[model samples]
Target chain A: MNDHDVIDNLAESDDCLFCSDHIEEAALGILEAEDQERFEHHLSGCSICRAELARLDTAVQLLPFAVNQIEPDAALKLRLHERFLQERDAEPTRIPSPRKSESRIRGRKAPSRPMWTFGSVFAGFCVALAVIGLWNLLPSNESSTSMSGRNFQVYAMQSSDDQSGGHIGADPDSKDGTMMAWNLDPSEKHEIWCVDHEDNRWKVDDLVVADSGSAMQTVTFPKEISTYKQIYVMRNDGTQELSVAPNQAINGDEPAPSESTPAGD
Target chain B: MQSLAEGHPEAMDLLYDRYHRPVFSFALRMMGDRDQAEELLQEVYLRAWRRASRFTDARGSLISWLLSITHNMAIDEIRKQQRRPQKQQAEDQTELMISLRADGISMDTHAILTERRELVRKAMDQLPQPQREVLELAYFNGLTQREISELLDTPLGTIKTRMRLALRKMQESVELQSLEAT
Candidate 1:
């Protein structure tokens, strides 16, 4: 045999722990002398390997400590057990009925529209017009809160055409005085503008035209503003305008009763 | 152990009772939170319940299987928290040294070895950082060398070497302490 063959044979001891492949094939115990010797040698010289082995040994030792009899809250356990039994008993009888399944399938095929859709769409358009018209017509309101300890009322404009007058006061409780208005004409472009109640300044945030039927845009006030008084929706074409005051008419074109009157709950 | 495949609640309860504490404790030590340990324990049991039919007696004892589960769950939870365990404080190191010296011997013997434990602790403290980490991970975290490699982002061979070195140093420290006591 060649010198390389002899050296390979000498290193390939049956008892060598480092030769895990041999150990696995032989089904030898971990504590075999070959394994122990290799481990001892490695332990003294190899810090990284020694640390890993130590961690493994610690984990093995700690396994017993991890086992604990976990008694969940007795009441909770009992309740869950009772529920399980009840569900187990009821499961068979509650199988889906044939008629119910048929109805479910039919329902999925043809969904119905609610009556409010048409009215809301029309109202949405009117509100959009009122918002824009009122924007140029009304002077912006400047109402600041007092530094004293009393809470003050905040307002914004909300215009909708569903009601005959097509105008309503903005929701006072809306923490942010933001509102939305839409244009009814699908082909016409619409603009949404916000009026800062505190600063009495108006800024156009968005302008978009409706593609098919109706257009809608939401306008939000800056976070710095504590309250708002009005929102206006105007046509980019400048044909019609719509607005909602904090508690007044939808558009400044008409004098309407202050919508801010609170109702007794 | 009863056959877990029979859907017997009693068998499940027995299995849970047998393995819950060790698993919980291991998880607690690994995670350092009672709530997380409890949660992990429950998840381990629930998984065991679901996969009970797959278990076989030929591979190893039920304890080893449960331990494997606990180790995986605890490691996962620890990873999720993204926490690295700080090195033990000097006082804790001293305390551990005392415990190692006492070796669960008699109370009187423990009292005597307490001072010597401080020396052992110092010796352990002198070990290289990697060796110390491997020793702690092995003894306290119960991670296999493979798991340790993944957790520490080191190769398995490297972990094994570190463990061997740590233990050898510990053995040396122990022998020296014995000589001093003599």
Candidate 2:
């Protein structure tokens, strides 16, 4: 730091080097490592900087909330869900407890205390990515049991004039699923509905088709899949895309003949 | 959280559904590329899932915890990319502030979060340009205060002063906002 750097504001008194400005730097994660270590040591006795650190930490936490919310692709959700299930199957009963360390530079008052083994967590995460890459390289039959019955096709309704269609991935036993469509008109609002036997419909989600003639979003099904009779995608003017049963075959933009229709609930 | 720790998929499903937007949005903001952001998003949830048993009520709210994870990961990613010789980062503090100032605030955002976001923008808007720029340089751009000093051609003391002032003003604004709400 330059000589003039000492002129920056301190908490209440200028006697302490561990001042409010220094703590703010720590909160911002810009404090040099040696200074951060010194600041941590100083926090043991200085209540003024400690209080300042806690208060500044709250404001630091708020900044992330100010970011613009851009929804990720629907397929990413499917990938995450599959990864989660695979993680569960691999380690069925153990959730690893973090090894405690003051490794990160957040304030002492931070409750969760970001207790990650950054190197190990990051290395393990990379290994997981490699596994995902390998899974992609394998043919369908090689990984059929794990990924079977996972892809769902959302076709265009016959009355619709557009050629828009989508594919949603939903694990058979899991309630979480995501849907996405392509060739959609960017100007239109489209909603996905999960319909039951008596024609009761639950609006799973609605997405504004994106500018690239494609869109995707998470679907929050109201009930379990076996309880739903058909899923439909409808446009704003009450135009329907396609109504599909959970267990039936839906070809690309066309409704195929069902060889094994699910029993109506 | 209990079910999550006890190895329940439904619990993981619930946590992901409730908070993934904020997590995903923050990751995308930091990474900028769609694929990179999505990859970061998946890694974050996977980490949380593996460590669910460690999450306790004392660890703070789930939202804060999740955001903290995102922040740490983004920092690592940014620093990693910074070390690469082939590519230079394109977005700077000015562009970041403009994007944040844009009219893309979604109507569907949760009410409490939306309120906090608006209040933060107002607080940020009230700062002098120099202080605001310094704050973003450190907070968002991940530039060390020393680096910011070099980048802006200012004294290190002056950059420190700006960062302190910016954060102090923001804290007061947030405290006042909560008081007004109550």
Candidate 3:
């Protein structure tokens, strides 16, 4: 019988011991096709077996635990990744420009053929992606209006736990830099860290995103910017809100430092 | 889990890293051959990526959901490759209860898994040999109760009873362990 054709609580529901005996097998996916269909048809009509099956389902879920688990070969991971790229067509998504009125604080020209794009197309992510591309292309930190050269390396922040955002223009030759940031939760105290390869952290400055969800700050680091491996924007509690490896503009695949790292966890 | 449906690659990558071991382990156990298990693992993740939006957290945890997909695909792959349900006895029934140590999991999680495995091992030990053989034949080797009944030269009704008893005994054993711990 079709499931819809099976009436609920059939007059025979109470006497479904025969079908109820099969609930565990059915839950384990071991019933033959015809037996499975018959069991399901009966299950639709029999409330008793349905309840038994509910309990049996939990028991059956435990069956995998009965087997000793073996770790698959590590190379299988790379093979699986290749399959994902092939199966999904993994085409990099193009970012559409924000409308003229939707534009925010400053007019930074978006770059063509940006290397990395976030799977999310939220306006904030797009802005960060664009600047990451543009910053890498620019010869120096200079407005087209002035054409003055500051020779800064762009460090664009990638958002992690929250929707917090930031883009920094740092002089690769020195410790001085300018930061344009947005979408930060204002209540938390935000700190910046410049970390070196030896796992050293320098508490350079506090990047305060105002109540308006954006901030601009001219920063002077305690150490030369070139010496650090990554610059992190984090909460005072050391929970990393966003992280960026130095020179984010060169490539989009640069790994950001860890995020939302609780002290003991 | 909702993060996966957000179409965020980072979220999917994060989840894949967390659960791949269990998923690969389950597929490896089911497929019984390393190459086949690896292929099945690739297909399972590919399916998960494509169908993340259809998965609802209210139904089950992501690991169980991933395993269900793995089981379904493995079964189909077995049939497609013309492999029938296992026709022989398990080489080592003890192997079924072998060590399960998943690296990178928290100690508490590892302990829970360890305890669960211990309870099941103890439960299997408690079962009559006939009942343990029947359960093993059906579960690890993918034999249906009918197939097991025929393989063991037992009546179908008897096989059903043994299977039900075995599962009930396992649940009882787990609950008993939990109660004793308290």
Tell me the TM-score of chain B in each candidate. 0.53, 0.79, 0.74
Output the worst ten-in-a-row residue range by lDDT, candidate 1 chain B.
Answer: B95-104
* Highest DockQ scorer: 2
Error of 1 at A248 (Å): 84
Name the docking class for model 1.
incorrect
The reply for model 3, stretches above 4 Å from the true place, is: A1-11, A14-18, A90-265, B84-109
| Candidates in descending lDDT order | 2, 3, 1
Which residue runs of candidate 1 sit more than 4 Å off their true CA positions? A1-265, B1-3, B85-133, B138-160, B166-182
Residue lDDT tens for model 3, B34-100 = 6777888887777676556556677666666787777767766765676654332253234443233
Least accurate 10 contiguous residues by lDDT in model 2 chain B: B84-93
Residues forming the 10-long window of minimal summed lDDT in candidate 3 chain A: A92-101
lDDT for each candidate structure: 0.44, 0.61, 0.60
Native-contact fraction for each model? 0.09, 0.67, 0.43
Q: Quick one: best lDDT, which candidate?
A: 2
User: Over 4 Å off in model 2, which ranges?
Assistant: A1-16, A19-21, A44-47, A92-265, B57-59, B83-109
- What is the fnat score of candidate 1? 0.09
Q: Please give the interface root mean square deviation for model 3, in Å.
A: 5.0
Q: What is the lDDT of residue B126 in candidate 2?
A: 86
